[model samples]
Target: MTDISTTSRRNFMKLAATAGGGLVLAFSWTNTLASAVMEVLDDTNLASGKIDFNSYLSISPDDVITIFSPNPELGQNIKTSFPMIVAEELDADWTKVKVVQAPLDTNKFERQVTGGSGAVPHSWERLRKAGATARQMLLEAAAKRWKVSADTLTTENGVVVHKASGRKLTYGELATEASKVPVPTDVKLKDTKDFKLIGKAIRNVDNYEMITGKPLYGLDVYRDGMLYAVIQRPKAFGMKLKSVDAAAAKAIPGVVDVVTFKNNVAVVGTSTWQVNKARKALKIDYEAEAPLESSSDHDRIFKELLSSKEATVRRKDGDVEAAFKKAAKVVTAEYQCPFLSHSPMEPMNFFADVRPDGVELIGPIQTPERARADVAKLLNIAPEKVTLELTRLGGGFGRRLYGDYVLEAAELSSIVKKPIKLVWTREDDMTGGTYRPAVRYRFEAALDAKGNMIGYKLRGAGINSGNPTREDNFPSGAVENLLIDSIEHQSPITTGAWRAPITNFLAFAEQAFLDEVAQAAKKDPVQFRLELLDKAKNAPVGAIKYDIDRMKGVINLAAEKAGWGKKEGVSQGFSVYFSHRSYVAQVADVVMKEGKPAVDRIHAAVDCGIVVNLSGAYQQVRGGVIDGLGHAIYSNLTFKDGAAEQSNFNNYRLIRMKEVPEVDVYFVNNGIDPTGLGEPALPPTGGAVANAIYKATGKRLRNQPFINQPELKTV
Candidate 1:
């Protein structure tokens, strides 16, 4: 039973005894948010009227260092990787360090978020100072005991050593005295050359516990008097609950209540199975005030919107129409993609204990502060009254970013007047739409008399998800007569942020179209991109948003590692993209297996600055690339009359283990601070696979979920 709280004071420290007779240290933070990186806390962060402190870390009498990890773990290895940053600076023996997961406490830790791959890049220097400050205090305590100058004492492997007198003391011997020393306002950090634990491979701290089923997920939370519940949402969009007949459901054993909200209904019982059964037994009716919508309807709307010339122009350089008129050749193409679901292994669930005075919400959430604020607004309660606890997620992938499920559970608890856990069944989760919006893009390019690429134009249309554009997109800031425009057609279905955000599908559309343009220019795809990137790197650009050198480095490295032109019996496809400050290039090799296009191998070159945990970075690249490949090749969602057509794994398929190709990942070496690798590797993988399929079978696929096409479906 471990819990942490925060307080602010001008230089004070307190040590208390835990239940196990171990020591717990609580201290004030002398430095403010201005001292840390500026990007950690957003403007909405409520850091007012408190002297914040480092509310983590405890030193036991036996020299066991317990450090609480600050960020939520979503299978990204932040639980193992973030603590390494601190342990490296503390000079502690890795074998003796113990890690604990910190709950959501904004007062204790600012910006306790795990999204946007910001855990390390935002908190690197701040956490280093935390460990370095504690080490300095321990050394000061040992120096006072020996009556020697503190400057003469050096620390190594959790011990403070005095070289002149040959006197040394373990951290345990100085813990009590160190608590009495004045907290230092400033501490010097160690150089990268001396780091011992950061770059090395370390096993996930929660690995053993997770494999042993030691109750790390929210589903494991239990209370003595809690009830189970299941929310029954509408089957389609623009649906309003007309009525619910719960007489049959309430007659079942263990059925406590059937609660009805403005838009949905929930069945409560003693167990999850009972509530789910009751929910299925209940008869409900809905009122529809709008026309029935389907995937075909969305497609028609997107096409109509694209045909309109009026649009919000995002970028325009030169006279695109004039360039196209004067060109020797002009080419045009269109790409379309369907809505996608995140499909995390864990279905949406939350445990909420709502009282008259406050609320306790526990779940696997990506953004705690946002959840707190949203819950407060819905319940008309104060923000501070809402307490959230973070749990190890089965998988996030941006599915947990919107905590609508959390709010639903809290509302159920409040209405039922009991602690309740709400779970969404697979069918309910599938039809309830928070999908990635479907989009369509129209592209046109022009080449000069010598077949030199000169101009570009793009028009994007989607259902409320307006458009996707990045400052460093291929040919961006490289072409003179370039123009990009987008229009939106609103839809009734719900949509939220997916992995890689808008850039996920945008990269596929842009990169695939560039390959076709290169073919028309009569040049190799890789060399054609290299020539444009050279232009973007040298002069003749508006504003460069990406490092051309880093981008080119990964592209060349991937081509070399993959042996692009040397591999025989396998057709290869190449693609590169930059996102979230990381550069990545991928090569995919394909072969016809049993008269179907099969991906044999994929090689990747990534430059995400410094690698925090070598093994974890490797895993991220592999997982992201495979996720993108699997989704682009076969994963898609369709709707009929505003309801999803697929329900579970039987209909909505994922990449199987047998289908995954051999993936090789490599990262460039550098001393720069580590950037995120969770997303950049995904954007290019889809395009690489698409281009490879084109080589294997001389057919151009302009739509996603390539397996749905007639010829490819035979496999």
Candidate 2:
């Protein structure tokens, strides 16, 4: 009965007739709070005595403040960090603040999508304004009661105090009165110096539920009488289902029904085990609909594309041909990275109940709004007829953004005329498409007599992924006569964003290539980079997309903390990158053990602007760095005749605990508005590790999954 919708501007806060007598406020972030309207649920929906306040928050008679985090939580700690933003402005006691996940209401929330590390930046001002507005209303209520000017009152931990008269009122006591006050359009925001909860380390709000085996993920969703379904999809790319025989599958013990839709077969049964067991008995035939491509074919295509002149130019500076012709030394290398799967631990699962009235969806999805729309479209129903409830995602890394699994479950439920829950086995999830495309980058840099980089040329070729080059990044503005271009080939194999996207592999290749250029010039690697940065700062160059001072800040901090070039017996490599509107610098430490180079630790320095929660921010940086390093060292996806060569973890290796290096995270807090943290820290980690390997064993890692190379071995 509680529904949130947007309307024309009226008031920022509205008094709700709640049975429990509490305040309610609602607003939107679009147009900077100028076009948003506020509403509160009536007393009929407040039978539980808890008011469904604004779209962002609800206050109770017991002094408890519940803040709704509209964005999906994918272990980025947004569920905790976002609420902290509100609590800071509300001046609420941290102990009494509660965080809840807001359901999918496109009208109520802005930018509900969770990927790209953009949640904080998108909601920072809006969330702060929400809390401040509520606090202002409370202060006005207290001032009216005391018959004093509102300016005379100050708030301390959810209490409005009039120090002149020694009179104070708790938020709970003034809640009913506050609800009657007119909404303040403009409220003063707290200065950064007064933030108590914004900088402090706060643990995840759902830690208790997550650790104690409480149901929080998509795979844990269940409903009475809901059937379990396991689908049988095409085993390889470029193939489609020609036919399917469901008789044997239906005959399996505990099997209830067998349904085929969208060229795939789904086995529905009483339990997950029954459906999974029944799926193994399905007889299906698939035929190639497109050219069956293999890893070798991609490799050949990459080489051809790099040498071909048919590439789209993204950026060009000065005359590259003239600069390279006059250079004393030319450095060239080719870097290759394979396709990768976003193998979230929970896999893909969704619960869908389709009926004539409406559709109910409950699961862990990064893009709930997109899923709602896709399901509505698939079922030929109105978008608003579908309601989605988001669960704590085990992990996304861009896999859940497509919502293919959600569509499958909705389709199955509609076909069988029953509520259904769909789950994918680990093998099915791995072999599924929408992978990080395989890419190759060919880099050539021209160095003059003084070993100063004069010209840089980069050509990137990728399968499925468009424009593999970040042309406006670090070196682009620093170097003279820089040229960047790319070529892409269409493939039946699906690919999408994986973590940091194109920058994930490109950063490593560019950084490692820079190190090689530095070595050839006989200059210190760190100094060489600093010199280029100085040139970009002082000299003439094309449009510089990255902030030079911020980039330098992280680089200086990471180098100083890691004790670069000061520790003996430990070889160090340095890498810095600017991506997703953030700058990150990482220093990797490597040592020779038993004639093999082993990564010991990583020192990461980030400048993502003002951090909301230090603890969560630190963990995010560490996790991103570790994820990047692990994938670079041990992860790669290959195909043989259109089928995935590696099905499970046994063949598709990942960095184990023993191979994981210690990560020390540091942040440069400049009080700038927050940008993104989920991806910036990851892009530079691969380059740092690659350079560290080069330092330890004098071998260049031009290929992803350094595991495949004989030069370096960690296990």
The prediction achieving the highest lDDT against the true structure is 2
In candidate 1, the residue pairs with backbone N, CA or C atoms under 3 Å apart (3 or more residues apart, or in different chains) clash, namely: 29-53
Evaluate model 1: give its lDDT: 0.79
All candidates: TM-score: 0.92, 0.95
Model 2 misplaced regions, further than 4 Å = 1-18, 31-54, 713-715
The residue-by-residue lDDT of candidate 1 on 30-147, one tens digit each, is 2333232111111122223233454555565578777666577888887887667767877887777777666666676777777787677777666676677778778888889999
lDDT (Cα, 0-100) at 562 in candidate 1: 94
Task: Write down the RMSD of all candidates, one decimal each.
Answer: 4.5, 3.7
Give Cα distance to truth, residue 281, candidate 1, Å: 1.3
Write down the lDDT that model 2 would get.
0.85
Error of 2 at 91 (Å): 0.6
lDDT of 2 at 2: 20
How many Å off is the CA of 277 in candidate 2?
A: 1.0
Residue lDDT tens for model 2, 1-715: 1222222112212222234677766657564334234444334444443432336566667787876677889898888987788888999878888776777877767678899888888778878887888898899899899899999999989889999989888888888788778887677899998888898889889989888888778777777778999898888898999998888888888899988777788899998899998898888999999999999999889889988989999999999999999999999999999999899898899989999999999888889998998899898999999889888898889898889999999999999999898999989989985799899999999999999999999999999889899898988788889999999999989899999989999999999999999999999888889999999999858999889999999999999999999999999999999999999999999998888888999999999999998888988898899899999988989999899988889988888888888899988979988999988999999899889888888888999989898666533
